[model samples]
Target: MAQTDVDSRNAQFWDELCGSGLARSLGITENTPESLQKFDHAYMGMYPYLQPYVTDEDLAGRKVMEIGLGYGTLGQLIASRGCLYHGLDIAPGPVAMMRYRLEFLGQDLGDRIRQGSALEIPWPDASFDCVYSIGCLHHTGNLPRAVAEVHRVLVPGGKAIVMLYHRHSLRQVIQIPVRYVRDRLSGRRRFASFGEAARAYYDTNAQGEAAPHTDVVSRAQVRQSLFRQFSRVRIDSQNFDTYVLLRGRIVIPRERFLNNLARVLGTDLNIVATK
Candidate 1:
């Protein structure tokens, strides 16, 4: 398929299945300040490790651009930290949603949030001090090009903090095959190969719609191929089952053992790279 067609399809999918769809299902429907706080609380509860990376120490007063404004949760948080915050999303839905969110929070950054592709970031070279994206780069059709755009937008020694789906994760190594067989046997759909199955499984969101493109990467692949322009790179695996959330705390069954295991085989690859 042509890149334009893929990007169009991706935009359509996200527009229809906005990131807040699940939160809306859970009864947090409005785009009010209260609802957004609830959404962020729930989101941070699920991914407890995420907030530590986005701190005043690294982000405050710096020009930071977030590539995917998923329901404006992190976008709002980053803006609140005194940074010159900018946001971009390939789909118009997120851009509009984020605009409302920032405005509601009295941080109206008109023209700073844009609708654009990660493959072609709508920014000049060395425009930002930090470029942050989570669960966004993996959805781009050409991840290497997206990474290049990220590197281009950052000033020298700037950081790119991104999260990509891990190729050799426990979800891919075991859960995908199990679900593939079950899905095939039940006539849900027939996937041509394990790779196809994995992509389909990962792309399908809580709303049961699959994104147009999705790619998983290994740490070595990210370091060697995707981020070769960087002077430094670090990747860490972090994942916790949603079932572990009790109240706001992550209460895993075997906390130590499972967390240690997750560090090695988790699906979320949190990467920090210096350009």
Candidate 2:
């Protein structure tokens, strides 16, 4: 596709994803918010691996910006640590939901949450002490540009931590076959909307109905991108083992194996860059 066409399509995809009433359909109301909360906790739990290299003290009293603040879990965590938390997401639903949830938690950090794109942040240069994106930058068509924007917004000594899908991971290896079978079975003519995709994941263990996974970056590409703009850079891997047997009836005890495999396969690449 042409560059302009690709940009237009990605923009439309995110707009629909944010606009869709999928959150409501997925029963993500305030009454039953634990599901989303749990997901955030899981991601935050991985911070320890990166924490040894960076400390919470380093983040204290600093302006921190997180791109794609899904469910506001990380933002809430950041706020709890006394850091100035600014979160932006392409989806308005998540933005509103996060604001409401945070208010209920009595952490109503006003004007800290906004709806925006990572590629085009609405902030000035050197505006943040730390700029980070977790499992978000890969969705953009211009990954390098997004990294450049993150670097652009960082202060002279700022830090950034970015998470992207690792093509070499075991999860990708397992998911590809599942997606293929699902797409063949669905026989749908067009890509499912964001709401439909969420429902499919909730009802079925398949994600083939959702938007296609975009680009996958290797460790070398990740290193190149961060090193080009920042001074210090480090890359590490994380793994989460999720699988089912007998069509979701039987569960597999692969967490230990997957964790080991992550160490072996070196999937789930995280890069920390200093500006």
Candidate 3:
């Protein structure tokens, strides 16, 4: 398919995904202050997959923009850490939920989050101190253009942290076929809840609803993409054995063992770039 066709498909898919009311079915609320707290717990539980490049002080007083603010979980975390948080997502449902939830928390952060496209962000050049997207850029049909947009929004000396799927991972190699089989057998076209999605991921070794737009790019490709617009670049991988074990439901005695294994295997790809 042509690039424009792919981009159109992706945009349509996300619009339907949000309009399907899946977020509410997943226990996401529009006016719940405790929703943010619950989201924090879920985020911490999934930290083994996402914690490598994140730092405690990364958000302190920084003007941060998060692309694909699913559930607004990470945005809330960044806001709590004193960073000025701006979140953008293609879906309106999650944005509305995020606004209501943040307002209920007594934080006037609704304006900070907007319904926008990652491919074409609505902001001025050099507008933010940091621009970050986790599990988002890969969904764009034009990955290079998405990266360029990210670069354009960062001020001089600003930084961006982006996470993308690793094409060469053992996990991805094992899961792709499994997902094919499961999707064929289930009769349902897509997942409706995070827990259901997580269960599918573990039981069938599939990405479930997340599979449609998932792209795995090589580390070299990621480096090249970031280097085109940023002066400093670094790549790190994470979530090795622990991710597998967690999905497999294997009772491992030492949690630290998985952490060490991740350090060695480097599964999830993290790219940090400075403008």
Per-candidate TM vs. native?
0.89, 0.72, 0.73
Candidate 1 worst ten-residue window by lDDT? 250-259
216: Cα error in model 2, Å: 0.9
Q: Pick by TM-score: which candidate is best?
A: 1
> Candidate 3 on 191-220: residue-level lDDT in tens?
664434533442221123443355667777
Q: Residue by residue across 115-176, what tens digits does model 2's lDDT show? A: 87778888899999988777677766678888999999999988888877776766555555
The full ranking of all candidates by lDDT, starting with the best, is 1, 3, 2
Candidate 3 similarity to native, TM-score: 0.73
- In candidate 3, which residue ranges exceed 4 Å CA deviation? 1-31, 48-55, 109-111, 175-210, 240-257, 264-267
Candidate 1 Cα outliers beyond 4 Å, as residue runs? 190-196, 205-207, 242-258
lDDT of each: 0.82, 0.65, 0.65
What is candidate 3's local distance difference test score?
A: 0.65
* Model 2 weakest 10-residue run by lDDT: 198-207
Q: What stretches of model 2 exceed 4 Å from their correct place?
A: 1-57, 105-110, 173-208, 243-251
